[model samples]
Target: MKKRFVIWTAGIYILYVLVMGAYLFWWADFGVPEAYEGTGADPATFMTDRQLELSQDYSRYQSMLYFLGLPLEWIIYLGVLVFGVSRLFRDFGERVSRFTFINIPIYVLLLSTLTWVLTFPLDYARRTLSVNYGIGTQSFTGWMRDQLISFWIGTLIMAMLITVLYVLIRRFQKRWWLYAWMLMIPFMIFMMYIQPVVIDPLYNDFSRLSNPQLEEKILAMAEQADIPAERVYEVNMSEKTNAMNAYVNGIGSNLRIVLWDTTLNKLDESEVLFIMAHEIGHYVKNHLLWMLAGSIAVTFGGLYVGYRIFHVVINRWGNTWKVKGVTDVASLPALLLIFSLLSFIANPVELAVSRNAEKSADEYAIEMTQDREAAVGSFQQLTVTALSDVNPPALVKYLRYGHPTMMERITMLESYQQ
Candidate 1:
C-alpha cells in the first residue's frame, strides 16, 4: 500500500510539473490578443520594456513557487504519516492530557507547529521573491509577526474544526461528511460576518475615507448602486506592499467598501470610482451570495469524495501507520492529505467560476460608470502597481487566476462603448 501510494504521488507530481512547466517555458502567447490590436490596450503602449520584463519575471517566479509549494506541502503531510511522527505526537498529546478534547487540541498544536516549522523556508522564499520584485515592502520582522499571527489563527481554527469533525466521525461513522458539510454552512457565514469587523483589523488600521471629496464621490456612487453605504473605509496598505486593491466585504449590516490606501494614492479620482463601481457590481449582482452557495456545493462534493478515500486508505494502512481507527486524532494528517489533493483538483473549477463572476463585475462597472477610459486606466494602473502579467499563460489563467487577466480586462473595457 505504501509503495502504491508513493508511486501514485510521484506520477501526479510528475504530471503536474510536465503540464505547468510546458506552459511556463514553452508557451509564448504573452501578447495583446489580435482582437484588441490598435485599441491602445497593449501593455507595450504604457509600460516600459524594463517594466514588462520585470512583470513577466515576477509572474514566472511567483507561479513556479506556487507550483512547487503545493507538492512540498503534500509531502510534509505524507512524511508525518510515513515516519510515524503523527503517531508519536498523538501519543505525546495523550500523555499530556487525560481528557480527549484537551488531547485533540494539543495534538493539533503539535502537528501545526511542526508543519509551520517545515514550511517556513518556502514562506521565506516567497517573501524574498516578493520583496525583490518590489511587490512587498514589509520588513522581515513585520512579516514574521504576520506569519506567527496567521499560524496561531489557522491552528486555532483547525483545532476547532478537527475537534468537531472527529466527534461527527465517531457519532455517524459513515455519514459524518454530510453532517460536517451542514455545519460548515453556518460556520462559513459566521466567519464572513466577523472577518471584516474583527479579524481584518488585526492586520491593518481601517478608518473612514480620509479625503472628504473622494468620500463624497464614493458615497454618491454607492447610493447610485443602492449599496446603502454611507462611508468608504480605507486601510493603510502602503506600509506593506505597492499593490492596489478595493473590495466589498462582509454580509448584511457588516457589508462595507474597503479601499487600499495604495489604490487611493496610485489612481486618480475617476479610476478610483471605476474600481469602486466594479466592487458595487459584485454587490448589485449578488456575486458573494452566489459564490457562497457554490462553495457550499463544492465543499459537499469534496467532503463526500474525501470520505470515501479516507476509509479506503485508513482500512489499508491503519496498522502500518499505527492509527487506531478512522476517528483517531492521529489520522488528521491522512484526512488533510486527502482533502489537499481534492482541493488541488477542484481549484481550476473554482477559479473558472470566479473569473466568470469577475468578468460580470467588469461589465457592470462599465455599464454603470460609462467611463471606458477610467475602466481601462484602472486595469493598467493595477498591472503597473501589482507587477501583473497582463497576459498569463492559458493554463496559468485557468488554474491560478481568480479574475480575468489584466489584458483581458483592458480589452473588455476598451471595447465597451457608451
Candidate 2:
C-alpha cells in the first residue's frame, strides 16, 4: 500500500529541521567570539579561574535545557497529525458532541489535554534540570498546580476562539479567515492588557515596590521616561526561580514595570539602575505597543497563509483525519498544523524586528542614564550570571535571538567613551 502524502511530507520536514539545526550549530556559519569581538587581548585574562568554571557550567547546563527540545516539540506536534493521534482526539470530540457551547469546549479540552500529555515529559525534564541547577525552587506539586492553572486558562481561551472560529466559518465560509483575523485584533490587545492583573497573579505574588531606595531610583527613571511612577511593581520570584529579570509589561492600567525579587537581592544598586533604565527605554519608546503591532501582522499573515493551505489540505486528507469541513471541530488539528508551520517560517522576521528594538533600547538606556560605566557593568554582570550566549551562531541569531547578544550590546556600549 502506498503511504500517505502527509506522512512523507512530515518526515521530510523533520529531516530538514534536523539538518538545518546541525548546520547552524556546527558547520555552515560561525559567529565572532566575544573575545575576538573586542580589542585583541587574551580572553583567558578577562575571567578569573573561579568565574571561568561557573560560567562554563552555567552555559553548558543552560544550553542543554534551552535547545534540547526545539526539534522534538514540533516533531511530536506534527506527528499527531501525520499519524492518527489527532483523529483520535477528534473522534472523541465528535462522540462527546452536544450543544454548540459544550461541544466546542469538549473539543478544545480534549485537544489541549492530549497536547499537554504529549509535551509533559519535555516540560518535566526542563523543570527538573532547572531545580537541579538551582534555577527553580518550586516543588513538583507547586509546579503541577501552575501547569494546571495555565492549562485551564489556555483551554478557556481556545474554547472561545474555536467556537467563534467555527461560527465564522459556517456563516461566511469563504471569508472566515479575514473575519477571524479582524476579531483577533481587539481580543489580543484586551488579553495583553488584562494578563498581568488577572492571569499573572495566579502564578506569582506581585506587590507594590517595597525597597524605598530602589523604588526612589526606579521612580526617577520613570519620571524621565514620562511613565507614571505608580506603575512600578515587584514580584516574589525567589520562591520559584533564581533567575533575575525585570520587564515593562501590559497596557494602560494593567501596565507596570515588574522586578523579580531575585534581581533585587543579587544585583548592585548601580546595576539595577541600568537595568531599570533599559526597561524604561522600552516604555519611553512605546516598544510594547510596537511589538503588539508586529505580533498582529505576523498573526494576520499566518492566518491568511494557513487559510489558503487549510482547504487544500482538508480536501485531500479530510476523510482520513475525520475532518468534514473547515467548520467541523475535527479540523482543529489541520488548522493548528498549518498555523504552526507558518509561525515557524515567520519567526526570523519576528526576531529580527525584536533584536533591532533591543539595540535601540540599549542606546536609549545610555542616553537616559548618561552613565556608560554602569550600563557596561550591568551587561558584564548579567552575561556571567545568566551564562548568556555572548556569541551564538549567525543562523541562531537570525532565527531565534530576540535581543542583541551580550557581546554585541557591550561592544556598542564601548562606543560611548566619556
Residue 101 in model 2: shift from native, Å?
Answer: 1.5
> For model 1, how does the per-residue alpha-carbon lDDT over 1-418 read when each residue is reduced to its tens digit?
5677788888988888888777776775666778665565677888888998898888888888888787877888887898788999999988998687889999999999998998899899999999999999999998998898899999999999998999999999999999999999999999989999988998889999999999998888889878878789999988899999999989988987999999999999999999998999999999989988998999999999999999999999888999998999889899999999999999998898899999999999999889998888889889988888888887678879999888778877777779
TM-score of 1: 0.95
Q: Could you tell me every candidate's TM-score relative to the true structure?
A: 0.95, 0.88
> Candidate 1: deviation at residue 228, Å?
2.5
Taken over the whole model, the C-alpha lDDT of each candidate is: 0.89, 0.76
C-alpha lDDT (0 to 100) for residue 172 of candidate 1: 99
